[model samples]
Target: MSDGPQRFAGHQSSHVDSDAAIRLTDTDAVTARYSAVQKGYIRDPFTRPLLPRGAQFQPSRPPLINVGTYVRSEGIDSLVTQWLELSQQEGKKCQIVSLGAGSDSRFWRIATGPHRNTVSAYIELDFSENTTKKAMAINKSRELKGTLGDPSNVKIVGGGTTLYSPVYHLIPADLRIPPHESLSQAFQLIDSAEGPILSPNLPTLILFECVLAYMSPAASDGVIKWFVDYFATSPEGTVLGGIVYEMFGLNDSFGKVMLNNLKARNVDLPGVEPYPTVASLPNRFLQLGFERAYAMTLRDIRRSCIGEVELERRANVNF
Candidate 1:
């Protein structure tokens, strides 16, 4: 419903290896507001403000392919902000950790916006190479850096993390490792940032944006199961939520061609075969110890946010 399966209908590597693709994608995202890019996201007020002052970049695809990217970013921002506000209204402490959050500016946008007080802590996890680049991007920009309280009090540690921000933290940790070991280290960073030990029992939300699809099903399963087990038994009644945005329908007609293209690059999508459809994903999550799981499709994004009227208007935009 987000109005552009037509947008995605038209859709890699730099210095950091496989992860470089993510960074470059984000690089394009920051400058997407430039009039020359012709993206619908040029209208995304949140995105433009989050970018550093002079982010110039080249287009990597025909503009149509990026329509879906911007729409999805807008939709996800709405989703996360809605939840954060709900948690705040309920008087619950909240933590949101975005997996593979490459140069995404959700935290800074939310922190400085009207709902700035909604979340207690926000953490971003990515490879060190990407996180360091993001940190520098934030620090160099007076606008980006201003959102994190007093500028002089801010600090980055281990080359990729902010060790002293009360609300914003950038953590560089490998998600492919055992979840307990990797996530515990991430939580400790949060503990330090927030000035308290993170209880196993805390209201937390984990966001995986197409990150799980790159992993083997076994690895993804283990991570989800690990989280379920860790928070399910908390005496304080910690409620947990996971918001996953995954790529599915691979091995099918349109997807098969795309999958093969990625495979040629030696990118193995181990999770594709195991959970190949959005419908299949919730069942997979339930089986992995998630008591309840929900999924939103592209159509849902269109219908739920942008209405049919706007969709038809965009349909007429010649690309």
Candidate 2:
């Protein structure tokens, strides 16, 4: 979902002039969400307000894609809601850092939800171009801007590429670069009189939705390791959870077809080449010194993670 500097083996650059194509995936992701919202597959009041003026008129995606989007969104939502609830159980508020967050309404959704107070901070990082567009969209939408508390408290920085508020922050970052180099800009920003934007004492959750696939394994690992080390220096019991939604098992024929389909558009999945199976996906974090990690497919989540009644409800709702 992000197009940053990519480094691969035996090649200086495999994706020359492909940043635009990689960024186009963000448009596809947001459009898919909008389509699902329009089809009643999901309830997202914020997606529409943040979309481009004429994006809504585009035709809805196919039924299969809509259902897939529903499952993926619900699955991630379950994990995030559980993280917030867990923090509440511990009598603490948690923070969420969503990487490659392109036109995602998750921060707005969580800020307005029941567990809003359970979240101490919600930070979103992405390419500067995407962040600039999202910042403009947010500033242009009253409903979106109103959720950030007092208008006086919200200000756009980085020449309108970044927006800051009481509990929400949108910062531009290239995940391909070193975390210290790319992420220090965010670390330097002060959320309030609170000293630092990110609190090391609080539990944090790193959300990677359809990201990391475009970068090399080393780059992606560095990003996660940076967070791991950052929290390791914090107070004890500072939990860190990561949720990465991506496609794996690309060595098969079906995977080949999917890869070819994407390659036709000039996009590559270098990171995915390392984790080819569901079982191997956890190694992405486990090897980074995380205590535990797990991976599940959308189909698995739909079958066991969701209730039968909810499944029936979704099934009965046709496009």
Candidate 3:
């Protein structure tokens, strides 16, 4: 009978506290982009504005980190390109949903690029803070102004509401906390297939860029199952698939380092232990009702896909 008011320090273990902390950790991806080119990571010409005005460099990443970035970005790029081309050929439109999209700059890059006409809509969802930062940047920047529409048309509201534009929509919603409940709530904000926003009948690419790893295994599975459910019930010829990029400790020295780094950031890899291998990656989705599933490690991808020449060139910037 000696308990008093709970201490604030003990609340650090709560989900709310962890979620906010991990958001800061997520910013590392943005900082890394500025040094990606110099570090031989990858080419990203549209990510600078998404970062802070006077952000510092973060070049002290695993050299092989470039391979991961390449695999994720190149893979998405290839998928998006093909999706766009096929849509153009079929004279249909498609949509892209970027989960935990933290000032990613993908919409602008894709919308203004050669395949600009292909993508009908691009939606980025994350916490309201991140969405607001991205929305504000898009509002203030000239590059992203006409990309969506007259800045006046862009709508920004508080939590649970979406910042809607003609092409790009920055939505603030929790991913998979509820059993299809939160997603259902978020759906109310989106236009239906018959409406003008994005065609629900068309193909969709849902990207989880190192986002799911932070979530518990059950929660991540909920996300996959939700998509499968949506595809199963949606109109015919509605293609749906996704890609997940994450680091599962390899049980090696590098794995230990990665684990320690993330732990230091107060971000726990809850799902990593469950699916630790490339083969295990796809099976996670296959079990969730996906027709096909495929995954490869960064090194395997570098050796087989990038080949000797490109890998050799990339090796110049040793980690």
Candidate with top lDDT is 2
- Tens digits of per-residue lDDT, candidate 3, 1-319, equal 0011224654654334446567775577777665665576677666776776666454455665665565656666776677778878887777888888886877887877877877767877787667767777776777676678776877776532357877788777777467466566565565556563434576888889878887788988897798778767665859887867787755789888878887787777787899877788898888999889888666655555566776667666646
Give the winner by lDDT: 2 or 3: 2
lDDT of 2 by residue, 42-84 (tens): 9999999777668899999888888888889999999999898
Mind sharing the TM-score for model 2? 0.92
What lDDT score is found at residue 203 in candidate 1? 85
Candidate No. with top TM-score: 2
Ranking by TM-score: 2, 3, 1
Give the clashing pairs for model 2: none
Taking the tens digit of each residue's C-alpha lDDT, what string does model 1 give over 114-163?
77876777887777766776787777777777778887677877744444
Task: Give per-model TM-scores.
Answer: 0.81, 0.92, 0.84
Arranged by lDDT, best first: 2, 3, 1
lDDT of each: 0.68, 0.86, 0.71
In the order shown, the candidates' Cα RMSDs to the true structure are 8.0, 4.7, 5.5
In terms of lDDT, the poorest run of 10 residues in model 2 is: 1-10
